[model samples]
Structures are given as structure tokens and as C-alpha cells.
Target: MGICSIKQMTTRKLLVLSTIHQISVLLLSDALTVSETSPDAPNSDDTTSINHPRNLATEALYINQNFRRMVLKRNEEPFKYDNPRLPFDEGDTDADSCVAYKYRSWYLGRQADGTEVRLICRTEHDGVTTGPNGETQMLTIKAFNEWDSRMASGVDWRSKLDTQKGAVLATELQNNSCKLAKWTLQALLAGSDQIKF
Candidate 1:
């Protein structure tokens, strides 16, 4: 009932209000995090399911196909290669007479949320040297996605061959044919919201 009691009451009220404000702020933060689905947002275990290799592969295919469609729609020509003996002459008979060639493809697509996705694939043919019967060769595949200036997931594979077999060397390339696709998908999903065309 005196001044000291009034001051004590005021101080208690202030402390309670502060505690309530802090609790509300924490709850609001949790709510925001749970609701956010953007690439930059923190993800729960469920959200991280997209990071699986299988999901990444599927995403890669989607991005590649979508990009191809975009290119075709724009009437643009994608890169192509048809010759087996390129960067080296068909008549080159030296043991080290190797010719290398690369083929690349790309596409662009917009996500449902309006994010732009870009995908690209590159295949390289190496050691194309002519022998007594035909040409010996090796192949490599590389692909990636670019969200704005940031390069996302990428994949690379090199061919394994027994060079001693010469022309008969049945080129045994460890064909990780899906590496590019997997990498592209990872990149697309990670940068979907952050990347700008």
C-alpha cells in the first residue's frame, strides 16, 4: 500500500511482460521456419528428402528435358556431334595419334514458384586413334547446373580401357550415365529460389 509496494508491483509486471514477449518471439520464429519452403530456408528431414540420390536423378532429368524444350521452343540449335573420327584424321595410325571431341546440351526452365533453372550436359570422346581395323576411343560425361552465378552439383566420369589391347581393346568405360542427371537435380533444388535468370 506504500510507495515501495507500488514500485515492486510495477517491476514484477515489467518482468512478466518481458518474458511473454520473448516466448512469443521464439514461437513466431519457429512458425516461420516451419512454413518456409524456399531454397534458402532451413529444411526439416522431410524437406531434405530431395537430397537423396534417386530424387536428384529424377530432378536432373526434369531440368534437362525442360531446358531442351525451352531451347526447341526458342528455335535454337543445341550442340551435336556425329563423327567418330574427330579432332584426329581417320588416317592417323600413330599409337598416340589421339583425337578428342566434346558434345554439349543445355536447357532452361521456370519452376512453379517462378524460379529459373538451367541444366547442361557434356560428353567428351578421347583417344580416337585409328588402328588396323577401326578407331580406339574413350568417353567421359560431365554435366552441371548454374543458378545465376553460382554453380551447383556436377558429375564427371572417365572411361577405363586396357590400352594394351590396341584396336581390339573393348573400351570398358565405367558408365556413370546418371551422374550428370543426379548432380543437375541437386543444383536445381538447392538454388531454385536463390537463383535468378
Candidate 2:
């Protein structure tokens, strides 16, 4: 984001990005909104407080236990959750709304048509979604919290960023080169058709 937003985006890149955005937006999402006004809901006026880390985690658990549902196929089903509880995992289960685990395969192949094909991908994404009509698509949600700053540790971005736009951009190549490359690979491997950022 910092790199892409810092300088001019090519017309071809913009076209491709906007096209993907349009298509992903049209995907059938039975997505749950924080629509109801219950006793436990966050205050409407203090919007920023609602995005707090604690609130987000609580909200995820609330959704995953009952409302969260995703597509799961392939034999990777058996290895859903880890045998031992991971520090970042909560084994939330119980009810028919029990969210199923989806298995992502990383054993990607197909490099050549000569005799044999070989491709090695060390990382894989687990965000695949299947529509009601059996159209498989990967849905990725990319956020922009980092782009609001010049670097990972800088503050006062609102005031300083405007004056140092050129300097900030100059650092993009030095700091974000690998990050940009990784995002490109992720878009290609994880969501070929439904890539969005």
C-alpha cells in the first residue's frame, strides 16, 4: 500500500485492480454486519473504539461460534485444528453453526507442458470460498492501516507525510521491495481471479 499509494500507478495496473475490485464486490456474500442494536453492541458515536483489538477478537469469536461459515473440501479436512492448542487459536465449537475448517493445498504444480511440470510454493492461503452455484473463488480482505504512515514505526503521519511525500516514496523501494513482491505472489497464488486489496 505505501508503495502503490506513494507514486503514480500505471494505467494498466489500475485497470486490472479496478476490474478485480468490481468482480470481488459482486461475489455472493452472506456476510454478517454488526447490524443489530443490542445491549452488548459498541457505542455508535465512538466509532474508533469499535475497531479496537479486543473488540475485533471478541467479534470474531462471536461470529465464528455461530454465524461464521466457509467452504471446505479436499482430504485436508482431518487436520483442521491443531492437536495441541496454539497460542493464537481458540477451539470454539458446539452448535450446528459449527464452522467447518477448509484445507488449502500448497503442492502446486504445472510449470511446463514439455514432459513434466514443477512449481514450488512454500506458502498457501486458506481463504477459499465456494458460491451456491459451485463457483470456487478466494476472498481476501486487505486493510490499509499501514499506508496511513510512512514507515512501520513513524508517528505524526497526518502532518509530516504531506511535506515529505517524495522522501517517503523514496524509502518505498528500500523498505517495501520484498513486501511488494510477496503481495504479488500471494495475489497470483491465492486468488488468481478474485484478488482485491
Candidate 3:
């Protein structure tokens, strides 16, 4: 009777140990499977993973927002003239030949469908002048498609006049266009005040 009791106790211990071993094996296998299938897991065959479309779109949007902010900040600053004298300016051939000083500015705008757009304004002047100097300012306003990085289609306004009329028109267009663009960008970024009509 004593020998039988001892054998029974030994058998119970063996069973418990076996069960624990089996469970540990199962758990380790499951963990390995999960690690292998995870999205960030490294692949043995291919070193690089393809970028998901959603991720790409998100990255592009982030880039556009940053660009818009930079342009807006630059527009708020005052203009500076620091052009070095070029060899072409040294020749004295024509008296009426005016030195050209080019300036470019950008603004943010919104479309009818709640999409934000960027407007670039380029002006050329004969000398270092603030704002639009009469008879010497050539202005061109163009819309830029942020996503496409190309000039926005169906929106082009330009003026080339050497008179007070041109300056007035350019100033008016710049003020109106820049205001609209800046407002639109601000609204889009803040996700408030949707433009009506």
C-alpha cells in the first residue's frame, strides 16, 4: 500500500510538469507568430516596405501646410534690397535703361469647395521702391496648386503698364488677392469659418 501511494504521487508531479511545458511552448509559438506578422516587423526577403497610400497623403498634406505657413510669415515682413551690382549695369549705353529689381510674394487662398490654394504675386520694378511705384511696376498674380506643384489652371492676372494706371490696378489686385488668399489659408488650417459662396 505504501509503494502504490508513492507511485501515484510521482505520476501526478510528472503530469503537472508536462502540462506546464506544453503551455509554455504554445505561448512562445503564438508570440513569435505575432511578431512576424506585425506591420513594423522586418522582412527577410525585402529590406524595404512599401509606403501606404494613406501615409503618403498625410505626409503631402503636412508638407503643404508647412509651406503655406512659411509663405504667410515671409509676406508679413518688410522688403529688403541687397542686390549686388552686375557687370551688365556697368555699361553706359542707354540713358533710359532702368535697373530692374524683381520681387516675389505669396499668399494663401481658398476655393469654392473648401480647398486651400496658394497665390504667388511677382512684381518687377525699375529701382528700389516700396509698394507699387507708378509707371515702373509690372505685376503678375498666379494661383499655385499645392498638391500638384503647378500653376493653378484657369486663374491668371497680369499687368504691364508704364503709367499711374498700371500701379493703381496692380495695387488693387495685390491687396484684394493677397487678402483673400491669406484668409482662406487661415480658415482651412484652423478648421473654422467656412467661406460662404
The whole-model lDDT of each prediction reads 0.37, 0.42, 0.38
Ranked by lDDT from best down, the candidates are 2, 3, 1
Of candidate 3, the 10-residue stretch with the lowest lDDT total is 145-154
Q: What is candidate 3's TM-score against the reference?
A: 0.17
Candidate No. with top TM-score: 2
- Tens digit per residue, CA lDDT, model 3, 1-197: 45568788999899999999998767544321111222332223432322332333344435444443343333344333476333346565453322233444456677899887866443233222223434322222222212111112211233323345555444334434543465365444433322321
The true-versus-predicted C-alpha distance at residue 130 of model 3, in Å, is 9.5
Question: Candidate 3: which stretches are off by over 4 Å?
Answer: 1-50, 74-197
Lowest-lDDT window of 10 residues in candidate 2? 28-37
Which tens-of-lDDT digit does each residue in 51-108 have in candidate 1? 4333444455455445434423234332233654445456765633122345444558
Best by lDDT: 2
Clashing pairs in 1: 67-107, 67-108
Could you tell which candidate, 1 or 2, scores higher by TM-score?
A: 2
Error of 3 at 157 (Å): 30
